[model samples]
Target: MPSDARSTDGSDPLDLSGGERFGVWRAARARRRREREEVRRFTAVSRRRRITWIASVGGVLTLAVACIAAAYTPVMAVREIHVEGARLVSSDLIVRDLDGELGTPLPLVDRSAIKAALVKYPLIQSYSVESRPPSTLVVRIVERRPVGVITDGDAFDLVDVAGVVLTSSPRRPDGYPLITFEGGSGSSGFAAAAAVVRSLPTEVLATVDEVTASTVDDVTLTLADSGAVVAWGSSEDSAAKAVALQTLMAAYPPDAVARYDVSSPESVVVDPR
Candidate 1:
């Protein structure tokens, strides 16, 4: 068919195509439309990926800043201190001494400072510290126990097994026996006396009055009421010796005997006063 020439409504004939030319033009237009659609699809995907990346990086940075601020803020700092397990050392004193930790972040409190402050207190044997998040601190204390007292003139110095003096008084305090040794505290006599005194049974210990040691081999205990001297020998075999003394005392009352010798533990003897 020839290119149609026609007039509709008295207009000029419309230009129209058929055959190869028309097919070529139609294919070109479709290709152009597909290319534009591809470009639009690619642009939308790239834009979405960029937005997601920006949001992820911004979120991570925000979290990092928040963590740093919380770590240093006063809201997480120490405001109060509590002391536990304290007996000889006052709990209030411990809390007051640790006041330097106040206003410090809970995670940043100095352990060395705490130890330094507690070192000045002689009664504290050991201690531990804890943080109760947001605003509280806790300190636990262990105190030394007095084993006996050593007398110098009119003063009585209470001492532990290690010979560290805990306190001193002018008058004798009850429930503690007197410790008398030839050498102050450096000698084997003092060590032996301490070991022997600590080894005595509870019942036998209450009846005892004084612990005396001239040498490691000559430790003695004088009964408080009867003045009966117990020859307690060395610290060795002390448990056995204590048992023997109790058995002998049962057989022969301490008040009736002047001295009870149980240094050998297995063999015992008593002399009448």
Candidate 2:
């Protein structure tokens, strides 16, 4: 027999047994198990990072809402009130006028309530209230002007150009005209009488003693310089009548015209006693 063909199990090169093969398989299986464990660990770490990111965003959103709420709350209340454009009016009183709304939210403050309160004071003709955030309140006022003095019982009241009673005074004003009217008449009649007096010529108006609005059908003027009476039937044709009276006074002496009737616009009736 040839030496190469002879059977020699003991001399076989690189021969592996069943136990060795099983050992190699076991080693590979161990490596795959370790790789799977590593992959699971990485996945767990990534999931924890995603959870942390979501929590951070939610925390930021909640903080922003809280900050906004704090800004508009009482922490940012109005600290000062600035009063402007008020003449012949006490700023303290005007501030007192807004006292009812003090400490109120500027955004929630009612303008109508402030206006109604201000209107209660006859001197405040018009007013404006402004607000600035994080602490400022501004106010402006316009006061009414006195046109004449009105007698209401023992006290005298100041009247505006529209004949609206403004305020009462202990003593009468020196330069303003005096007005007298019958109590119980409508305000329209008194308003008309005031309008007519304002429409009179300056020279004639300066000499007027008292303007009486006793009846709608008749209006009377008493002269201050001479204590003479001028009968004006009504407020109708008042401007024309005033002009006619002016011309008559210029042409003829006031003494000659005792009772001047300027009720008619085109003609004049004079009665001299």
Best by TM-score: 1
Model 2 lDDT at residue 72: 66
Q: 149-236, model 2: which lDDT tens digit per residue?
A: 8877787888886666777878887766787776522375676567778778888888777787777658888777666677887888
Q: Residue 250 lDDT in model 2?
A: 78
Local accuracy of candidate 1 as per-residue lDDT tens digits, 1-273: 796455656555444456767888989999999999999999999999999999999999999999778867999899899999888778988888889999999889999999999998877788899988768898888898777888878999888788878888998878888999987876787789889888888888888889999989999999999999999888999989988998998899988999999998878888998
Error of 2 at 110 (Å): 5.3
Error of 2 at 57 (Å): 22
* lDDT at position 151, candidate 1: 88
- RMSD (Cα, Å) for all candidates, in order, is 11.5, 14.4
Q: Give me the overall lDDT of model 2.
A: 0.76
Give the range of the ten consecutive residues with the poorest summed lDDT in model 1.
Answer: 8-17
Residue 205, model 2: lDDT of 82
